[model samples]
Target: MTDSAHIASGHATRPIGGGGGKIFGFPLRGFGLVSSLLLSFASALFTFCVTTMVAIFALLIYRANGHAAVDMAISYRDFGFPASLVVLAIALPLFLTLWIRAKIMG
Candidate 1:
């Protein structure tokens, strides 16, 4: 069928072939890898910092409650790094899914 017939019938076929992919009017093909990495890493870093701070604070409170010297290393070893890894895992897939869906459905 002709393109005009599809349009007249109130049905329009979308172009799926990737050609200069863009989403929300912003160029994405060229930046998809960089953007995805940046977004995921940023999320992980933020989670690490915040969790580390909270861990340290909790350790300080523990020390104040008469605990034998709390090890600051536990903040990174036991809490922050693991939380960051989990965040990175979650954020990377979430970002990639949204990115791919946008590119395909756009």
Candidate 2:
């Protein structure tokens, strides 16, 4: 069959995807199964990491200063870890809930 014949058949094919799935509005297309599974978590994890870095930088500058900053920087390095995770945990559900509501509304 020529290209024109294939096109005329009206059976335009979809590129192979990562099998069957849709998390939120994102289709699990062109990704591996593991990547598809992790896609949902990726946003939350990115949010958490960025928040942690910002918090650490802010705390270091505003709260910790000079000699105190050095000491606190080392001792309280993990301080932002729990705080950011908690924030992410709380925010993620809220995000998903709002996302679902918006999807439904549309």
Candidate 3:
């Protein structure tokens, strides 16, 4: 076989960018594989932060109005209820989204 012919065939067999190939001119494999997980984590963290901020504001307003009991109510069992609410607020939707994503990918 001619050297040119052998070289052409080798080029054809080589993966685009050496296993870093693009799909329809868009690179979405390795990065996309972890993007969903990363997004979910960020979303959950944001939810928790926002919820805590809201709860703190609520307590402050109540405290200013001379009803300190506002803090203790939400702090039931040392903030367990409010914390769990925030977690569920983030987790439920995240779980459903990831589940749907897996099904769609498969």
**Top candidate, metric lDDT:** 1
Task: Tell me the TM-score of model 1.
Answer: 0.68
Each candidate: RMSD to true structure?
7.1, 7.8, 8.8
lDDT of each: 0.83, 0.55, 0.57
Encode model 3's per-residue lDDT on 1-106: one tens digit a residue: 6667878778434444445445588443333435656655665566556666677676788788977466444634345445656666775565556546555764
lDDT by residue for model 1 (23-96), tens: 57755443375688897899899999999999999999999999899779999999999999999999898778
Each prediction's TM-score versus the true structure: 0.68, 0.38, 0.42
* Backbone clashes in model 3: 0
TM-score, predicted candidate 2 vs. hidden true structure:
0.38
Clashing pairs in 2: none
Order of models, best TM-score first: 1, 3, 2
